[model samples]
Target: MMHSLAVRVYYEDTDLAGIVYYANYLKFIERGRSEWLRDLGIDQAAMKENSGHVFAVRRIEADYLRPARFDDLLSVETALVQATAARIVLDQTVRRDDAALFAARVTLACLDGSGRPVRLPKGLAEALAAG
Candidate 1:
């Protein structure tokens, strides 16, 4: 039940040494998570507008295992590891071929328009549970 996205490393993704900047790995996984939700028919904007709820990152436990260089084609994979009423935990990885370059355990919290923690929408909870 892994959701994956393909990303090509560009010159802009690289640091002065020509390897991808460490922080950019977070960006790559963020895109992967967005696509994963989209694939599940969850629209963040719609959720915010209709349900008055939005998602925010609560924590991330990340590991930098290897370096990805410019021009590399990478795959970001995301899977739901756990889900609760107010939070979801995901395991994500950035890989080049068979090698893992980065990995993270991400916790996302659902929040109301006022930024107060709230329960996840039933649809989102069900989708993750089914997966």
Candidate 2:
């Protein structure tokens, strides 16, 4: 099963045309990824204090299937597409219930303070594999 979260479009999330701005799609996908990790008991705050490591988006490819209008309650679904020693790929989608409005694949690399590549916490890596 995929990790899911609901995002209600507010005026701040939209453009002058009252549609979700193209770039904010990334934020929705970020939320999905955050919750995905949270579900597996990965505490982002604790990670930083203990490991000095954080996950950073290394790549993203998006497809705008349709427009999501203001006030639309959208579901952001995220699944682990791949996970390796130092990175994870997530298949993220925004849907209005059953209708997909946007989709993307996001690759995030685990990094140290200087942005050098680092392995994900061993437990989190195993968690992704289990999923």
lDDT of each: 0.96, 0.91
Tens-digit per-residue lDDT, 16-127, candidate 1 = 9999999999999999999999999899999999989998999999999999999999999999999988998999999999999999999999999999999999999888
Candidate 2 on 1-131: residue-level lDDT in tens?
A: 48899999988899988899998998898888898899998999899889888999999999999999989999999988888899999899999989999999999999988889999998898887877
CA error at residue 47 for candidate 2, angstroms: 0.4
Q: List TM-scores for all candidates, in order.
A: 0.98, 0.96
Worst 10 residues of 2 by lDDT: 122-131
Candidate 2, residue 61: Cα displacement in angstroms equals 0.5
Model 1: pairs clashing at backbone N, Cα or C within 3 Å: none
Query: What are the clashing pairs of model 2?
Result: none
TM-score, candidate number 2:
0.96
